[model samples]
Target chain A: MARAIPTRRRWLLSLLAWAVGLIIFFPILWTVLTSFKTEGEAIAAPPHILFFHWTLENYAEVQQRSNYIEHVTNSVVIALGSTLLALLIGVPAAWAAAFAPTRRTKDLLMWMLSTKMMPPVGVLVPIYLLFRDWGLLDTLTGLTVLMMLVNLPIVVWMLYTYFREIPADILEAARMDGARLFNEIVHVLAPMAAPGIASTMLLNIILAWNEAFWTLNLTAAKAAPLSAFIASYSSPEGLFWAKLSAASTMAIAPILILGWFSQRQLVRGLTFGAVK
Target chain B: MATLHTRSLARLMMAPSVAMLFLWMAVPLGMTLYFSFIRYNLLIPGPRSFVGFSNYYYFVTDPAFVAALVNTLVIIGGTLLITVIGGILLALLLDQPIFGQGIVRLLVISPFFVLPTVAALVWKNMMMNPVYGVFAQIARSLGLAPLDWFASVPLLSITLIVAWQWLPFATLILLTALQSLSEEQREAAEMDGARRFSIFFYIILPHLARAITVVILIETIFLLTVFAEILVTTNGGPGVATTNIAFLVYAQALLQFDVAGASAGGIIAVILANIVAVFLMRMIGRNLEA
Candidate 1:
């Protein structure tokens, strides 16, 4: 129970909090606002705060000049594809670890997590070379597989944590009722695990959507996701501020919306359940 | 409670993930090790001969390597300092009773969801550009000169962008931990006439110690490999100014096609990260029992 502060002090604190929050959020807000401005307005000497000659020309031109739909499609496919694949492989592993008591289960879980700590650069050369040799470069399937591999540990860890919370008695009760092994999982486990699985899926998709290192190194124009699409603006020729803003807004808006819903899950997932 | 049939089934279920991860970790890492030992260049497609320690020697002795090592440390250390401190303050503020606290948190965490490329490009052109950037506009309004952020302070600028992206993560985690701190303890301290600073220093800070350690360790892992922000913002430099070890290896492998040299650099990065990983794993491992 927090002490009731004086009303004046509470009001002052509220003002301070709102000011800090708005200032921290200003960059993203500015980008979103700039996305609606004209090229000249975007780079205006005195930047337009609110009142501007607003236009959707940048969004229209961004789509026309660069196939925005294709990049969007690529991002969707890669993010969802990798997340689903990770779930497919991660669920059973987590279920086993959560339900079964083995001396090595803890060790195995730690090892899986330690794999994530290996810097991607350590294996960049081989992965790049292998992708090149196997013609996996600039391929959606390749990127999906790579993303799945990188995020698999988190998926398993999150599911394991969630599954651990569920009582073994439920499964035991099901088994006592003559339910077969497959029937036990299908009937009792899946329904109970749906919420956990969904959050895991959401977080992984967000991670894959924003993954830049592999996407940048492996893909060219053909299979480039939004990360690559936005990065295309890095060079000066692609430096139309309004168009860049439009593209950036498009790239981030979906994930940002998704991310809001998964904020709780994100803390649990990223911290490997250490904080929680 | 466990039957033999179920135990075997558990192992079977775990096989795919275990085997896949094993292959994933072993294959590429083994290849990187092998590549590092040989004189391999992508441009020179001939019989590759064993160069043993020469690749390591050259990669280490290169001037760029030293600069990259220093830049990597600076970026990691700088970003960690900013985010952790900023996060603690923000978390404390948010913990107070405030109007529209939910919306405030939503706004604070928004940047963490922005794609790295998008964040970098947004900062590079819209905020940091000398002529027409927001900073320039602010500077001109104050009758001061606009600073060329990338050219003048490439690494620091990148550090700021990365720190902005990560500050929310630290805040969210710290706030979560703060909420769990026992209220009775605080009330007791307050009743004992401890002022805010005394309570904070003796009680709140100590309670937040584990959370802070977790934040530092986790952030260090991600911060060590900050690539896209640097790649998009500076391309590793006005002149190798922002090139961390990750970018250094990338430039060697992709730009120069020096596979052997790049592999050696990759090994060095792995070693450096492993040192940090060892400590982090121990910290997390201890938490498991609790």
Candidate 2:
């Protein structure tokens, strides 16, 4: 197993791997390619792969048809807003648990984790009624708050995992060097935890961005993010293939790019650092 | 480290998250519990009264509940079977000495990042459409009939789509775990003259056991609540053919306006999830101690 593989076998394996990878990624590739085609070309028999009249018309038409900018704006706001809020609330809790564990802290951690287990459906009716009665429905603030709460446990869990890896010795050394509380955090802890924090934030933003259930149920015209906005295309529309592709491509593009950068964190974060 | 001041400060820091999560869990849950025991319908409002267990009775007795329950299990089981097995094989492939590893990994992992709504729609319209879809095209090219994915096998179609998204996740975690298996250990196994199949079962699968459990537990929890794919594609049916527990509760509340019945269904779903959650919590708790 340690010896170098024969060149022929390597070539064959590489070819097989590449084939599988392309097959897995074909749907996304097809969508992006279809976005550049005319409606007719999108569904053309013996569909065009690269040889087609490529145009930017669908991108423009999609925005005009759906006010796609509004949805994009909403997606940005909700994803960013919820992520920030989760970090704000999660960091301290995670920090406390990681650094200062009491006998009850384990129980407390367990309790927080249990909250994550409570299926959203179990609480859907009351939350919906509350959103309706309190006039929080279809508002960025409401959705942001809901998203924040929805993601809070995960945020805290991920942060706790990262924070646990940080040795107390470094902070103690910083303290011995006459660093104050704020200075120790800013100068010492932040740098050590920065990558993990960035990963957590990126992952949280992507999750919130693509969140569909509450977004579809809670929003209509006003607060609809791209997730809900794209659902409108589900109903039959005339010659909408290219337009749909364009919309989907835009909906996923930002997150897709962000996701590539966060692949390392995806495993760590989703596995709760179990694999790492 | 355990000084009173630090402990107090720790508690203070932990307060907001705990309090918020407590309120989030309690208020809606309490309200759902209350509603589950009473008669409430948004359509026919006014004069609400207690109707102990009747809502549960009706919700469970509804034929849709049985279908939704079975379909939910199918999705959870089907996706788990596909993703876990497929993931192990893919992880093994990616773990090999291959060129352009990064790009191939990028391609493989891209689907996990796609929005469920977008994935659902793309698969429905472009990949699986009976007329003019890629699969249809492939079928025609092969001189075979085009299979209508949603019309014929809605749940299986949903499972395939969901599995496609989750496969990357399983593959990635398993790969990470695989990479961590030291070369020295593998080389030692080779020196001991273990066969390839024996080496994998004895050394590799055992090493992957924890990671596999991690994938299964997390994926099961998430799969239990698959809503967007069904909502966009089948809207829960060619006659409720694809509705799962989450979608069922959703239909009861939003579509049908049966508040009490939906609350009952929601509670039942919660109960169903707890069975998995118990194992998950234990796993995590063990990890914490470790």
Candidate 3:
């Protein structure tokens, strides 16, 4: 018996879902809207809900006043750089953990995960001191290394999950055919897991690009990413709504586009290895 | 010889990453533990002395520590409540027949990819500005008084916004679980004359138990350490009402340059997080085992 929800109940549920979704997404929508208003109109009394002159002046000011390109470049370089570094390190490590498990492999994986559980601030002072002493403070290399290390655990974990999904028999077949270990992984494993790897890289790059703590703490000017670019607008000298929104929209636009396009891959990848 | 060579090669491939992560985890943490036991402050640079547990003593006794800890707990608890409930409800709804579901899902997931600083700035400036925000606009249109979200009564509105950014994660995970559920079992319940509510409560909810646990554990780990949002929006402000331990430690170390005190506070936070993490990991491990 196929029992169907009544029309009224279905309508109610749909309306409720739409309302909740809108409420959750309102902030992002409001930000984009405010970016077009004048500074005065952006923070007008009773709030300009709809009636306001839309202008690109705020974006022009944000671009003219701030070194938007430098931060954008820094964000791109660091996010891509750290993600690639994490992958370079994570791939082999995950390969070993997934395929060549020893008595201590699980323990090792757990320990690696526990490191992520530790509060980042617990080590911030030491890292800050270390960075300052090593003269890596405010350097792209410094942020790259730090972000890479922080994001490595997730990379390894995700890759391990993906690797576990590949049948061990295929690798055995390659070995039986006299393929070298490197050739086996390169040919058999890498291609099979490419989708997972690509998604992992995308996710990690997003995480790194969005990271704010180390970027704010370690880098002041030269290595500041889009995160820091947004933070600068948060001056104690009162808020600049239009310009702040403009900067924020600029900062998130690229990742937002990426996310919109790759939503399927992102969702599938994250849930794929976990449920099974 | 080839087998041995392959194993050794595997070990060799793993060594650099292992060693780097090993040092990355140990060196700073080792420094934190050492610093916690010593008398050290950046402003008062001198020969440091080992002060067994006084730093911890002072840190635990400080009201700032208490405030920060409580705030951390409240935010974590508040976020967990909102995300879990909201996520489950949203997932259930999205699982229903819907128009433009993919686009909705993408919009819903978009916030999670947003940079924390940008999200916070967007919320603080464009949405929660109290005066010129959409919330105020709606309130005025509805003939109700507008409320200042960051002020007296609803300081946590910003925290909720930050938590909202993460809600999609919980929804996606849970929704995946929901979709993977055995349809035959649902039909069995239907045949058994189980009411819709009973079917959901008895069958669907239990099927989602594992997903819920995963969501709770992953979200808790991140929520306990939420920093960027607080830093950008509140700065632990409006009278330290929003200060979590991370921000507190940051202020102590960077703003005051009190390395010893900050280290002590940091250790305390680590201990607390570890307690929750242990339970969470155990649950996940057990779930995986099952």
lDDT of all predictions, in order shown?
A: 0.92, 0.92, 0.81
Question: For model 3, what is the error of residue A186's alpha carbon versus the real structure, in angstroms, after optimal superposition?
Answer: 2.7
Q: Write the per-residue lDDT of candidate 2 for residues A138-250, one digit (tens) a residue.
A: 99999999999998988998889998999988887887898976687678887999988998999999899989989999999999999999999899867688999999999
- DockQ head-to-head 1 vs 2, winner: 1
Judge the docking of candidate 3 as incorrect, acceptable, medium or high: medium
Better of 2 and 3 by lDDT: 2
- Chain B vs. true chain B: TM-score per candidate: 0.98, 0.98, 0.95
Best-fitting candidate, scored by TM-score: 1
Residue-level lDDT tens digits of model 3 in B108-222: 7778888888787776656666676767777888999888888864448766776778888888888888988877899898999999899889999999988887787777777
Q: Which of the predicted structures, 1 or 3, would earn the higher TM-score when compared with the native?
A: 1
What's the lDDT of the predicted structure labeled candidate 2? 0.92
Which candidate would rank higher by DockQ, 1 or 3? 1
Give stretches of model 3 more than 4 Å off: A1-15, A44-53, A236-239, A261-276, B287-290
Query: What's the candidate order when arranged by decreasing TM-score?
Result: 1, 2, 3
i-RMSD of all predictions = 0.9, 1.0, 2.6
Go through the candidates in order and give the C-alpha RMSD of each one to the true structure.
Answer: 1.0, 1.4, 2.5
lDDT of 3 at B129: 62
Evaluated on chain B only, candidate 2 has a TM-score of 0.98
Instruction: Report lDDT (Cα) of residue A92, candidate 1.
Output: 89
